[model samples]
Target chain A: MSSKIRIEDARRFRVGDGFRLSDVDPTATPGFSGSDKDLKKELVQHDEEIGVLQEKLHAEKQNSLLIIAQGMDTSGKGGLIKRLLDPMSPLGYRVQPFGRPTEEEAAHDFLWRVERALPKPGEVVCFDRSHYEDVLVQKVDALAPAEEIERRYGAIVEFEQQLAERNIMLIKVMLHISKDFQKENLRDRLQNPEKLWKFDPSDLNARAEWDEYMDAYQIALERTSTETAPWYCIPGDNKDYARAVVKHLVVDALRTIDPQYPTPDFDPKAELATLESMD
Target chain B: MSSKIRIEDARRFRVGDGFRLSDVDPTATPGFSGSDKDLKKELVQHDEEIGVLQEKLHAEKQNSLLIIAQGMDTSGKGGLIKRLLDPMSPLGYRVQPFGRPTEEEAAHDFLWRVERALPKPGEVVCFDRSHYEDVLVQKVDALAPAEEIERRYGAIVEFEQQLAERNIMLIKVMLHISKDFQKENLRDRLQNPEKLWKFDPSDLNARAEWDEYMDAYQIALERTSTETAPWYCIPGDNKDYARAVVKHLVVDALRTIDPQYPTPDFDPKAELATLESMD
Candidate 1:
């Protein structure tokens, strides 16, 4: 029998902090020994703040927030979003899964396709895989050149700035899973039938050049983290710790928004007959 | 023999078109009329646009839209959203069913609770019965005075303006089902198990004073319609016609959005390598 539950429990704190070298199981290198108590405490405040901001934003009907997540083949983007947004009100939240560009999409400029999915005000939209693929995969596949990638990073800044100027919040997340952790993730997918579809053979090819992709991501982080749209590199070896961090970031962002109620309209009188009748 | 299909079709429309007219046969409303040829042609264009938006938005990976339907008790909100958004992308979109306001909501401003449900930017949110209920129900029960209703209307306008400022497109639908049509709707609901949940004997109380609600709605439309958001009074008697109008509105909105793809980045060596590999 496998020690799955123990490993699962250990997976929660295997990042940020240094893990005990002696306890490192043969399955994969453990990250850090973290305290769930700390993680739980941190998440409570964040969850509350998000709740308030969500309500305020909806009521104010003000700026909407869009979150875009991108990372390596097994970077845990899906897991990150799930944990980060679980506490949000289901009514105003949306999660969009990205896939291959369609024929119509191919006809338009890369950003054209994205512009159409912009959320209405007072909503939160999360991109599982964003336009970064144009740079990430295109460069990996030689579909695009460095000049194009450089241009996109700078252009992204402008695009994001415009949204910020108009009050649409933009947040980007990159799940940083180590090569060793990724292999474990791949193993999980392979062994489990339920997760089999998630594993694409192409992902194996991509994993081979992991270091090159890391360089690309490093450049992406440095070039794209702007005042308008900031990027957070989350540690993914420890799922719980990662969730804790993401939770904090989202709540912090929402609380900082501090939306207010639209001004009240009805007065105490004028319809005196009606008010009296309800009583 | 009862015409179930006609009743089903009628449920798809906005309220108040055929009910006030002379006696209704109650049996002849089912078949899809070929007379609406021009409208059908327009719907095809709308359908094409929708497909384009669905593709483009999916690629962009930015945000989602929520459409909320809100109206008088017998309003056809549920039917409209179900048919309109069903085929698009259910994963990226959501429909929230709001029951009576909670005590917490009543304690705050009328818009307080609703604020929690607004969609994020670049999203479409439809309200079945939104904050307007404060004006509608309050007016009906004499719970709130005229001054209060006017004030709430202003709040709604400000709230919508803020939503537009952010990116969420707002569409408020007031399904204007007539008194007789409402009776038929109630009868159908009671007769069908699937629809019984929608029926409430209390809905009959307001039916006695249909003109009062009409006047209230007219005031709502007059006060709340703005450039940021517009109020459409859909005719509920004819189901297909109503669906057509809604489909037209959605298509019109998406056309205005005209989403695009993000620019890509590239490297010359990488590009050359990819091209050489492909060759």
Candidate 2:
């Protein structure tokens, strides 16, 4: 696939003004124009580039990258994190998994815990299920009142704007998986003993509320995907294709950031001589 | 103050085997060998060095630094953080304040919230109060059973060791203040309308159990001040002196780490030529 065309096609998946979730097909691989083997080769190249860029970002120490992964239970957030970050230095990246909020987190504004989890300068942080849960799960289950949920969308946009202003490059991705795809994933988890640990009965309840969850995600994506921090709805039925697309998106952002190794403050020639003398 | 001697004197306050909190004179300024003006000047220098070194650390991005501040309610934890981090870039630093844990945090191990608050690589994080509180306040108030508190000390040692193994420079400081000094601070808070918000009724209750709290601290410092994360007891009665001492300690750690700006991977000359051509 021509990377230029692939990037443009991927951009089409980005939520923008008047976008609709129904317009996206979970099984469609818009960006991958190649066979599976060729796609794998492309992913490897992206991974190598990401690794180098991450080091430069670390050296630059002026900005941070935050990737927020949100999706249904079987949509592969964990798998994506493992694959994307595996080639990078552990020191420069972290994965923060947002599970059930502890009582203390619930006491404050929903954004409080998320603010605490943001990346420091020169770091890349991924949130596996992020603050979007406040709008998604809360809205579907009616865990929060309607007005409060409405307020959250506004809060998220403002919060994301502030993050961008603070030099945090925020990428929001929703793993778009069909109901049938999710059912297959759930069945696989149940049938395979090794994968059974991943299964949760509560996931079935979420599945029952599938349409409600999708509506919640649709509204959230439409309202909060601003010029800064756009949301990309990745086709999750083809896990390998989805992973490659996400990798491309992340690499594209890194290329745009284009962090360079900072100039040395001290004289390296003199420092090297001093080091040799010490030996 | 002679910063070299002050750093040494501060070392004397670090909790080691057989250390006792009662033996520390909270009113003493053991290392300030100069007048107030000289001490102020030294602190300013330390601040400048800290700011520069922090930048280098951020550029290097191989390790992180975590500073934990623990003390009585009015013992100047907030003031110290503001003074220490004020000269540094906000992008590389974060401050996490631990109050009463919410119901969710309470359900997990005491270290769960703390682990969540740890710094990312190339970052400096300060905790206003940390896991020590689980043993300090919890033990003094019988908030947790004796056995649980006992388990926590061992857990803390192992946790700190793991952090050290992961290239996290852990510095724990206890702002030691006399009961009389605390009383004066509390009285000042009550009298000054501007400071009234800082006062909590709980402070009085804590004051009532002063001796018990000291005993708790004495035991805690003895049990958990491992070589990996030693505890420094900074006299808190004189805020300026305390701030300078903390500054020196932090600067010393940065010097030991000696982070340097990384070498460029690409040819800067060629890149500059390309950019010049574009312009």
Candidate 3:
């Protein structure tokens, strides 16, 4: 496993014009050329590096990070998040899961709750399901007026830009799992007693209209992927490879930020003497 | 490394009537006859077990947990919290660090802010510092009126009882460190460039009045340690042992809760068939 995995052209995974979901293979591990053992070894190293960067980010208390993970059910969003943050100290980052809105949340504008959940300076926050749900599920199920949904694209772009200006870097990930993979995952949930609690009968309703959801995601990805807050469409069938790619994305973001420990105002030698002299 | 390290007498570390801070040795590792290698192996196993229990707790969505870690500066509160929650999913638990009160926070009652940060059902919340700050720092520094500080003790008892009734189990741990140990830690912070950012000049002020803080903690522990929420004074000089004991304390609480995966309300066989038959 190389120390540098050629993240130079990571943008090749970004969504652009005519970015059809069908064009990308869900099973592909684009840049990584490693066995399963190698991938595991690489991930351990990534975890350690990410951990160190996260501490520097915390110590600097200047920039912040927000990773929004949007995926269809059983796309391994939960597992991906676990692995991405496996080595991080719990204090430095937080995971925010967005489910169906409650009455209060529903009453407010779509961005209202999201704005409230934005990361503070020095914090790394992950959104399991984020504002993209408005475009994906809402558009697919026709939960809102089509015109209202159309207006949200520009609103999202502006919102993300504002976040970037505030030094809150955003990594929007679309975990692209094939329909067959989702079926297999749902099957596992149904068959495994330990995992049965995760099975929801309503999950089938979304599966019934898979193509429409795909179209919705494609549109959202094209509209939302910008230089500041770009969306990385990760191949999700191979869980290990997908997690490794996401880890790289995070490490790359932190590296770009280049957070450093703040220089102390007080003299270190004098403080040491003062501390040592204390009764 | 036995499967069950006898936690039957875990309360031996708890503060009770006639409790004194000086009595318990900071270096003692009671009931643990393991070598350093054994402790490391045992921790890995504990991590896995805690992961399973945490999942069950999240699945059941019935009970919640609150672990409060209060210790003097340089006593390893931050490190202890990291190890305690290392294995849990970020979504299932939150680490809330309570620093000096902000203007808005100071305007509200002490418990007001704490109540807002409490874990919901099925979640685990850890407080690096907590409402105890009101009793500890407030009492030692005479920040509040004497009568007001005296009244907070009974209020905390009632507050904790209310939490217990709501099934939010609380584990309050005071990481007991000797003054000599703290001096060594502060000296390291001053010498190590990577650690210099953590060295605050005012940390020595707290060290200067160490005995006052200890007296304050002793009083607070005796008053607040009840059947519902007990304070565990763990020896902190041995960081590994302190962390292991805290892990056992958490694992024991989860075991007591015994949160089981919810029995599927929908028939699994039927759901499996339904999912399989879907287009």
Candidate 4:
């Protein structure tokens, strides 16, 4: 059987002023196949080019990136962080994994801790969970005053703007895993001994409040997606595909940044080969 | 053919103290084979219980670490950084690959920039080359005042003491390759086309003043090696062996600091299994 696919067909993504996060299909499969096998095949195809691109960025050492992976628990943050950073040189990159803020941090502005964690020029910083935690968790749990929650969002955008102004590129990835995926993920962790350390009982309470969290995320995306930094909603049900999408975004952004070597006065290739003879 | 090796025999190193930087035998094959290999192996091998130790320390997340590497033009800073970090999770790690200091950085005290790169609780920060730059490069080129040069070493030790007080463990490495190996490396860069970008013509000019630079490095290491953050003089001609040695040093230090997971309030495995079934 043969079928015609329109150029404008399902691949098009719209984020209207009035669009709600729920209105967006959290589980909507965009491509021909939703299978993880298809994603592995597609992702592996770009491996060589992507590897070259990574080397180019490392060599150029121009732009510093702070990759914010913000999703609820079980959103594939850990897995995504591993895959994207695995191929690249760890020398110029870093990751900040935040849990609850310290008392000293809470006493100060939310961004203070993050400011300390930001990568210098020519470095890349990955935030497994970042400042957004204040807004997301605080809003859903009613842990803070309503005014305080509202203020944090504006504070986040302002902080991000300052980073952009300073030539730091920020990538905000919302690992959009559906409730179904979360349930299955939680189940897998239960049966597996190795994954025992990952299971948290309170996750059930979070799932109970899933709809409320969704509404909160909707507003979070709507308010925060700015011109300098746009939110890339990654369909994360299939873990491998989510990884591929994030890696695509990372390499594409690096390509845009285009890292280049600092023109050392001598030929490096010849220099490297000198060791070949010593063998 | 088997003979008993004594403890002192095993712990003994080839080159003694007071050797110049280029005096290091980069081409000397490390004990990678034979009885001598087994004799010296224990000195190189720290406790292999590193993983178990790290897991315990992962819980308290108490002490942080910073590994700083500094040396001349062909010194093995980049390679050192890679081997140290290759085994660990990139999640709680940061690397600062400093080039020329920014004017803003130069305006501040030399330690300010380096201080800013310190890792937080339970994280590790590796500097491919660090603040010792002002002393090393400046001394070699007569770029800084002798008074200023002398003062910073004491200040650097104090800076490291502060880090140690704050529970930041520091490990410094100076990869010592002999003048012979460096000459071979420089020639390789000049002769190969692929290494064109890395070739710096004046590397030979710098190599010409080899002894002067070695004296500078010797002074830097002597002044800065302290109880809290001692320096390791790694004989680095054998690239693979150097990588292996640095890898084990990191493992050794990290194991001693150790890491442990925080006790979960709920069984993560059970939670994960439940989540997996939600679909």
lDDT of each: 0.62, 0.81, 0.88, 0.69
Tell me what TM-score chain A of model 2 achieves: 0.96
- Lowest lDDT 10-mer window, candidate 2 chain B? B270-279
Q: Sort the candidates on lDDT, descending order.
A: 3, 2, 4, 1
Candidate 2 per-residue lDDT over residues A104-182, each given as its tens digit: 9999999999999899898999898999999999999999999999999999999999998998998888999998888
Which CAPRI quality tier does the interface of model 2 achieve?
incorrect
User: TM-score of each candidate?
Assistant: 0.50, 0.54, 0.97, 0.75
- Per-residue alpha-carbon lDDT of candidate 3 for residues B1-279, written as tens digits (9 for 90 to 100): 533245644557888778888898998878777688876765656788899999999988999999999999988899988888888888799999998899999999889999999999999999999999999998888989999899999999999999999999999999999899999999999999889888888788789889999999989999999978889998889887788878888899999999999987889898888888986
Task: Write model 4 residue lDDT over A1-279, tens digit each, in one string.
Answer: 222222232223323366566655656555435455666665555557655555555555666777999887888897788777876778667777888888999898878898988977777778988888788887899878989989987887788888888878988888888887787677776665545456667778888888888888888888887778777766667677667666666766776777665566544555445334442
| Chain B TM-score, candidates in order | 0.76, 0.96, 0.95, 0.79
Ranking by TM-score: 3, 4, 2, 1
> Which parts of model 1 have CA positions greater than 4 angstroms off?
A1-33, A37-41, A265-279, B1-93, B96-279
On DockQ, the stronger of 1 and 4 is 4
Query: Would you give me the overall lDDT of model 1?
Result: 0.62
Task: Report clash pairs, candidate 3.
Answer: none
lDDT of 3 at A256: 94
DockQ of every predicted complex:
0.06, 0.02, 0.83, 0.30
- For candidate 1, lDDT tens digit of each residue in B12-34? 43333332212323223333445
Off by over 4 Å in 4: A1-20, A23-45, A61-66, A98-121, A142-170, A180-205, A226-228, A258-279, B1-23, B33-59, B99-112, B142-167, B183-205, B222-229, B264-279
**Per-residue CA lDDT of candidate 2, range B1-279, in tens?**
243336787677788877878788888888677677777776677777787788777767788899999999889998787677756655466777788999999999999999998998889988889899999999999999999999999999999999998889988999999887887776676555445545566666687788889999888888888888898988889888888888888988998889776554544444333333331
